[model samples]
Target: MLDLRSLRQNPQAAKALLKIKGYDFDTLRFEELETQRKSLQSLTEELRNERNVKSKSIGKAKAAGEDIAPLVAEVGDLGERLDAVESKFHRLQEEYQAFAQSVPNLPDASVPAGSDEADNVEVDRWGALPEFNFEPKDHVDLGAGGMLDFEAATKITGSRFVVMHGAVARLHRALIQFMLDTHTSKHDYEEVYVPYIVNADSLYGTGQLPKFAEDQFRIDSDADFYLAPTAEVPVTNIYRDEILEAGRLPIKHVCHTPCFRSEAGSYGRDTRGMIRQHQFEKVELVQLVEPGRSWDALEELTDHAREILRALELPFRTVVLCGGDLGFSAAKTYDLEVWLPGQNQYREISSCSNFLDFQARRMQARYRSPETGKPELLHTLNGSALAVGRTLVAIMENYQDGDGRVHVPDVLKPYMAGLDVLDLG
Candidate 1:
C-alpha cells in the first residue's frame, strides 16, 4: 500500500511509476473520494464539538436552577447527526482501502520497457552444455524404469503429479539437501522453516492476493487459509510488520519446501513428464537490504543461484525480464535457464529478482537508520537457488547414457550415498 500522504502529494508521479507494471488506476474516483472524505470527516468533528458545547451549557443551566431540559434535548439531536457522519466516513475509508489494494507497486527505472518474455535481455551464461555420447532421454523416459511413476501419481492424486519411488525418490531428497547446504553454508544465508499455508494478509504483503488468486488454490473452510504456491510467501513475510536496526540491513534467509500450484489456465503447456507438476520442491533465497544496496545485492544473489548450476556443470543462461514479463511484485527479474540436451532447449531452473521496497512497504517491513534515527522501508528480494523438480529434470536429461542409465553429478554423490549412475531394470 502506498502512503496516503504520498498519494495526496503527487498522485500522478506515483501513477506514472506504476504504469511500468501495467496499472491504470481511476484518478477521478480517487480525487472525488478524497474530497468527500475531507468534508465528511470535518462534519463529524463539528457535530462532536457542538455536542460538547451543548453538554457544558446544559450542566451550567442545571446548576443555575433554570432551563436544563431544552439544552439536553438539543444536545441529544446533535448526537444523532454525529452518528450519521461517522457511518458515512467509515464507509468512505473502506472504499479507499479497496482502491489502494488494487494498485500494484511501481517498477524501478532500470527495468527495460517491454511487454513479454521475448523482449527480455540476456545478462550472461553459466557453465557448459553436456556433451552426450548418445541420444538423451527426458526425465520421464529416464526415470520410468526406476519407479518415477506417473500412472500411480495420477491414480492417487490426478494428473500433473508424480510419485517417485526407491532410488528416484531418494535422488530428489539428495538434490534438495545439496542445494540447501550450498545456500546456507557457502552463500551465508540463515536457514528457516515457514508455514505451508498462510492467510490473505500474508499473500497481499507479497502481492499475490486479490490479483493472482485465480492461479492459486484457496481453502473454502473456516480457516480461509490458502495452500502456498511457493516458499516465497512464508519466507519473505518473516519480517512482516517488523522493524530492524540499520546494522541488520541485509538479512539473508534460505528455505526449502514443497510448493503447490493449481497451474490454472496452463492448458496444453509442458503437460508431459514432471516438467510441469502441481506439487514440487524448491530451495529459496531471500534478502532484506537498504534501498541503496539492493541492486548490488540482486547481482550477488543471481550469482548465488548460478553457483548450483556451475557445480553441477549444467549449462545455463541468465536473462533480464522486461517490464511486461516481470512478476507482479518485482521491479526487475533475472531468470536462469538451464540447458537440457534432450529437448534441445534451455528451461528456466531458477529466477532471481529485486523487488526493491515494493514488498517491504506492503509487508510494513522496515528498518530504523542509525544515522537519521528514522525508520524506513527495507527492500526485499527472493529467488530460487534452484527449483528442485526442474533441477532433477536437467540432471537426468543431461546425464543420460546410451544404455538408458543416468550418471549423477559429482557434487550430488555424497547425498546419493556414493552412487554413480542409476541403471534401468
Candidate 2:
C-alpha cells in the first residue's frame, strides 16, 4: 500500500508517477472522498461531544430536582446521528482503501519509459551463446525417451505438467540443491523452508492479491488458503506486521520451494513444454534492509542471481524492466534472461527486484530507527536466484551433444554424485 499521507500531500506528483506504470489516479474522486470523510469525521466528533455534555447536564438537572426529559431526548438524538455519520465514514474509508490497494507501485525514476517487454533496455551481457554442431532440440524433444514424460503426467493430472524420470529427475533436483547451496554459502543468505500454502494476508502483503486473484490456485477451504505462487511471497512475508530491532538491519533469506500457478491469463502460450508449467520449483532470494540501503541491495541481489547463471556457464543478458514492464510491487526490476539453444532466443530465468517500501508498507514490516527512535517501514527485495525448471531446460538445450545426451554442468557435478551425463538406459 502507498503512504496515504504522501498521496494526499501531493496527488498530482503521485498521479504523474503512476501514469508511467499505466495507472490513472483519479485525484478528483479521491479529493471528493477526502472532503466527505473530513466533514463526516467532524460531525461525528461534534455529536459525541454534544451527547456527553447533554448527558452530564441531565444528571445535574436530576440532582437539582429539575425535569431532564429534554436533555435525555437531545442526547439520544445525538447518539443516533453519530451512529449514522460514523457508519458512512467507515464505509467511505473502506472504499478509499480499496481504491488505494488497486493502484500499482510507482516506478523508480531510473526506470526507462516503455509500454512492454520490447521496450526493456538490456544493460549487460555475460558469456557467449554456445555453438551447437547438431540441430538443437527443445527440452521436450531432448528429454523424450521416458526421461521427461508429458503423456503420463497428462494422464495423472493434466497438461502444462511433466514427470521426469531417472537421471533427468535427479538433475532437476540437483539444480535445486546447487542453487540453494550457492545462495546460502557464497551469497551469505540464510536458508529457510516455508509453507507451500499461505493465507490471504500473505498474498496481499506481496502485492499478489486484490489484483491477480485469478492467477492463483486457491484452496477449496473456508480458511481462504491459496497455493504459494512463488517463494518470494511466503519468504518475504516472514516479517509481516513485524518491527525488527536496528541491529537486524539487513535480513537475507534463501528459500527453495515448489511454486503453483493457475496461469489463468495465459490460455495458450508456452503450452508445448516445461517452459510454462503449473508446478515448478524455484530457488528464491529475499532481503530486508534499511531504507537507504535497498538500491545497493538490489544490485547485490541481482549479482547473486547472475552468479548462478555464471557458475553454470550459461550465456545470459541482464535487462532493466521498463516502467510498464515492471511488476506490480517492484519499484525497479532487472531480469536475467538465459540463452536457450532450442528456443534460439533469450528467455527470462530470474527477475531481481527492489520493491523499496512498497511491499513493506503492505506488510507493515518495519524497523525502529536509531536516530528518531520511531518505527519506519523497511525496504523489501526478492529475486529468483534461478527457476529450477528453466535452468534445467537451459542446461538440457545448451549442453546437448549430437548423440542426444545431456552433459551436466561442472558446478552441479558434486550435487549429482559424480553423474556427468544424462542418458536413457
Candidate 3:
C-alpha cells in the first residue's frame, strides 16, 4: 500500500512513476475521493462540537431547574447527522485504500524501462552450457525410462503434474533436502515449516489477494482457505501486523513447501514436462531487514540462490527484471535462468526480489528505529533458493547420457543413498 500522504501531496509524481510499471493509476479519482473525505471530516467535527455545546446547555438548564428537552433533542439530531457523515467518511477511506492496493509498486530508478521480458538486462553467467554428442532430449523424453510418469499423474489429478518413481523420486526428494540443508547450515537461514493453506488476509499481505484471484486454488471451506501459492506467502505473513526490536531488524527464514497455482493465463506455454505445473515444490528464502540494507540484501539473496545452482554445477545467468516484468509488490527483481541443454536455452529457475517496504506497508510489518524510537516499515525480500522440480528438470536434461540414463549430480549423491547415477536397468 502506498502512503496516503504521498498520494495526497503529489499524486502526479506518483502517477508518473507508476506509469513506468505499465500501470495507468487514476490520480484524479483518488483526488476527488480524498477531497470528499476531507470535507466530510470537517462537517463531522462541526457536528460533534455542536453536540458538545448542546449537552453542556442541557446540563446547566437541569441544574437551574429549567426544562432541557429542547437542548437534548437538538443534541440527538446532531448525533444522527454525525453518524451519517462518519459512515460516509469511513466508506470513502476504504475506497481510497482499494484504489491504492490495486496499483503496482513504483519501480526503482535503477530498473530499466522496458515493456517485456525481451528487454530484461542480463548481469552475469556462470559455468558452461553442457554439450551432448547425441541430439539432446527434453525432460519428457529423458524421463521415458519409467522414472517420470505423467500418464499416472494425469489420471490421478490432471495435466501439469508428474509422478516420479524409483531413483527419480529419490532425486526429487534429495534436491529439497539438499537445498534446505545448504540454506540452513551455510547461508545462516533458520528453517521453517509453514501450513500449505492460508487465509485471505495472508494473501492480501503478500499482494496476491485482490489482484491475482484467478491464479489461486481456494478450498471449499468455511474459513475461505486457499492453497499456498508459494512458501513466500506463508513465511512472509509470519511477521504481518508485527513490530520488532531494532536488534532483530533482519530476520531470515528458509521454507520448503508444495506450491499450487491455477496457471490461469498461461494457455499453451510450457505445457510439456514439469516446466509449468499446478503443483511444484520449492525452497523459498524470505528476509525482513532494515530499510537501508535491503538493496545489499537483494544482491546477497540473489547470490544465495545462485549458490544452489553453483553447487549443482548447473550453468545459469542472472538477469534484472525490467519495469514491466517486475512483480506487483517488488520494486526490483533478479531472475536466475539456468541453462537447459534440452531446450537449448536458459530457463528461469529462481526469482529474487527486493520489495523495499512495499509488502511491509501492506502487511504492517515494522521494527522500532533506535535513532527515533519510532516504528518504521522494514523492507521485505523473498527468492526461490531454487524451484525443486525445475532443478530436477535441469539436472535430467543436462546430465543425460547418449544411452538415456540420467547421472545424478555429485552434491546430491549422499542424500540419494550414495547413488551417483540414476539407471533404469
For each candidate, give its TM-score against the true structure: 0.91, 0.95, 0.95
Q: 229-317 in candidate 3: lDDT tens per residue?
A: 99999999999999999997589999999999999999799988999999999999999999999999999999999999999999999
RMSD of each: 2.8, 2.2, 2.0
Whole-model lDDT per candidate: 0.85, 0.92, 0.91
Write down the TM-score for model 1. 0.91
**Candidate 1 regions with alpha-carbon error over 4 angstroms:** 45-74
Can you rank all candidates by TM-score, best first?
Answer: 3, 2, 1
Q: How accurate is candidate 2 locally (lDDT)?
A: 0.92
Error of 3 at 54 (Å): 5.5
Error in Å for residue 307 of model 3: 0.4
Q: Write the number of the candidate with greater lDDT, choosing between 2 and 3.
A: 2
| Model 2 clashing residue pairs (backbone) | none
Task: List ranges where model 2 is wrong by over 4 Å.
Answer: 49-74
How should the candidates be ordered by lDDT, best one leading?
2, 3, 1
How much is the lDDT of residue 301 in candidate 2? 96
